[model samples]
Target: MTLVDFATSSLSVLPAIIALGLAIITRRVLISLGLGIIFGALLLTDFSLLESGKYIFNTVKGVVIEDGGINTWNMSIVAFLVLLGMMTALLTLSGGTRAFANWALEHIKDKRGASYLAAFLGVFIFIDDYFNSLAVGSISRPVTDRFGVSRSKLAYILDSTAAPMCILMPVSSWGAYIMTIIGGILLSHGIADYSALGAYVRLIPMNFYALFTLLMVFAVIWFKLDIGLMKEHEINAEARLNESHKEDEDHVDLHDEFGVEESEHGKVSDLIFPITTLILATLFFMLYTGNQALSSSELPFSVLGAFENTDVGASLCYGALVGLMFSLITVFKQKLAPKLIGKALWIGARSMFGAIIILFFAWSIGSVIGDMKTGAYLSSLVQGNIGLHWLPVILFILSGLMAFSTGTSWGTFGIMLPIAGDMAAASDISLMLPVLSAVLAGSVFGDHCSPISDTTILSSTGARCKHIDHVATQLPYALSMAAVSSVGFIVLGFTASVLMSLAASFAVFSMVIAIMKMLSKR
Candidate 1:
């Protein structure tokens, strides 16, 4: 085939490749994604500039209007995300988050305690990675800064816990969406109505990356184990604090420059009640939407069954709306003027504009990729290279790379899940769960480290840390976990026992951490 003919192939994944390259090179996700969308439109139009422009316009219009498949659910996610941004702004403006920080700082004595508290908050908010990143980073930044914990370290804790915890939890939005992908694949394979939830539950122990990533957060904190770039950042943070102390003895303030303004009247309950309401409302809306999604024949209802039927984006949107309403009521009760609350809400929504733009472009490229059958091409390419025994490890690595390049775990999941599911069903691999778990684990691992990832961005934004600094510091920690998890997946490929594999993986992680501790001492 000629060069032009080759480029026009139906399975071309060049648009995504170009997009990722642009993102990495320019460090501008929106521009990269927009370029990718343009490239995809051009490809669809056979390089006709006029047609490509029209195609691009239609794509954006459809995405915003929810006029087609996948975009509708995606638009709902965007709505909730904007609502969540508003909610976060209100919490910050109302001083609920600041009060919570004070409450945490009172008990958290020293840098180590502050780090653990930050990690704990990240773990606690498990509903959505976006929420987890925003809430934990904002809440923990003050306490972490109080004791000179690096913004990078604070970002690490926030990024590490967000997606990893979401993936491990079967009830979260991540789990629900993944289950749907698995269900579709299974149905295509003639396994009529297999329970994706049941499969996901069984695979939890197999998610070594998520498990190890969470544990490593504590291991690093407790052992004071700082390795690679993170170590340097922590040391520099201490040095800066000391320098400031000596230079301005009378002017020295313990508060971080990024610290939120405190409210003397703000109670811990101010933070707790609204957050609790958000979580509860999300679950309530999920279940309610799930119930409505089911057919009369499909349910007199079990929890998993309802989850399998759930409209993830719609539920999240509804939950966010409920949370926003409760937050307004709470702010009013706090004696904040209605106008102030309204202003805060608008400010919050405005803050999400950047994230919203990225999401739109991300979804656009995802649609392009889907239409091009890029995932299928990737699956085909990999299937020819690997034996069934090697499938789990290989898929893990491939999924990781895809997620790292794409900078959006959900988009990666949408691309890879069907491919992995179909491959598992077709191959003698017989162990689909391990492969699925690996995909989930790897996607999170990639997101944890990716400079362009939304969670990573939010973590830095939340901590008011330099974005590249957060990426640089978190990469070493993420790579450490990924190295250990890679070995764990290989072991699981051979043994195929989730419990035994988990135990073995945990042991491997401990050994790795022990070695790192010894090396750091040296």
Candidate 2:
């Protein structure tokens, strides 16, 4: 009803578009985000340069501190990133990385296995997308690197598996959050046919983008279908690996930026133990926090209930702290000098500085987007105008656009889910799940394509890939999956049959992949 109340009617989209274009063209993430933040601030401040400066400062302040208190969620995530970086350094210093790589080389025996390992790790770590991206990247990077798999490819694998897998599993933070939203939506619509968890599970078959994107990950690897820019990256990765082998023995590891030589006393357990501790500790805290939360509320202490109420940001921070301790213990066992350990810690924290800066700017712009009502304005454009049968498809596209513009999947969910539920309930009760599922599918798709997204940034950081390179290479795959899923949503809206829609989507996905593989051979 009050679309674009904060700024210009259509100018709200300009900042995001400018940011996205600059990111792709200039290949400088921070600059792009900075410019976007400035434009958004100007728009929010009615183009007054001085006022825009104030707006920017206040917005950034809000991100760091809310209601005169620390933004614990945001700050905790930042801390986790720093801790994870430190843990990674310790892994390297203790020679755990090298030993793990050597072990992978001997056991995997080929690049395909390495690729599968990356994909497996990505899917296996589904508790939170942030954790999934960073942990999988750390665990799989050494193996993937030894096999000459491109860092961009590893990032792609991480980005694809992290959010999609988490969104589908009820035990995951994503799933729990989505279910809570769905519960409110269902109650508001007065629908009694299914519970929130039940609705989510039923919608799984209808979430074409998430399902298709996931299968596409394995399909791309199995078919060797590296389309578009990805092929060139794979070629360059092999060349780089070959060139490294021919270099003299004096070649130092590029990641050893601290000038502290890694110890030769590292073993496979050095890598495994700390990482395992991180995972287990994170999971434990999630339940622990969730259960504690239930004690303060009326909710019972079921696993799903705990997950639904868990403090993800705090849990990740706690987990990282514990994991770092394990890494420290491992490093100490090797008798590495104290100076070297401190240097490793410094390198670890410093490596995350760029990511942290980008994240802050990204958050700042997101706040500006919210203040500008960009998402609300975008959703308003299609409301009450589309036919009922086309609602699902349109919502999927709309949700994708909203998420792409705002650079957040959860934000898109928050905005679109209620609108979708209201629309479906008013038109046809049968379409509720379809439309709601479309929004979920589209959000994940959009988040994948967005360069400013936290998941995208973290994926690149984890893989040690250039952020722009990862974005450029992953774009084609995301768009390809999105294209096929769009067609499926269209069919779904008309037929209202989950089985038929899934059958059609997968059928088309298979054909598209087959044709691409055939073309590659030629």
Residue 482 lDDT (model 2): 89
Q: Give TM-scores for every candidate, taking all chains together and pairing residue i with residue i.
A: 0.82, 0.96
**What's model 2's lDDT at 267?**
91
Q: Model 2, 1-522: lDDT tens per residue?
A: 112364337877888998999999999888998898888777666678788887888889988999999999889989999999999988998889989999898899888899999899888889999999999998998888787788888899999999999988889999989999999998887888889989989988888998988999999888888877788778777876888733222222336445546678789999999999999999999999999999999777899889989999999999999999999999898888898899889988988888898899889888888888889789887776688889888999999998998999999999899999888888788898999999999999999999989999999888877888889989988988888898899899899888888888888898889877976565
Q: Pick the candidate with the highest TM-score.
A: 2
lDDT of 1 by residue, 321-396 (tens): 8887877766777787666676677767776665566666766776666555555555455657576777788888
What does the lDDT come to for candidate 2? 0.87
Candidate 2 Cα misplacement greater than 4 A, ranges: 1-8, 245-254, 518-522
Instruction: Output the number of the lDDT-best candidate.
Output: 2
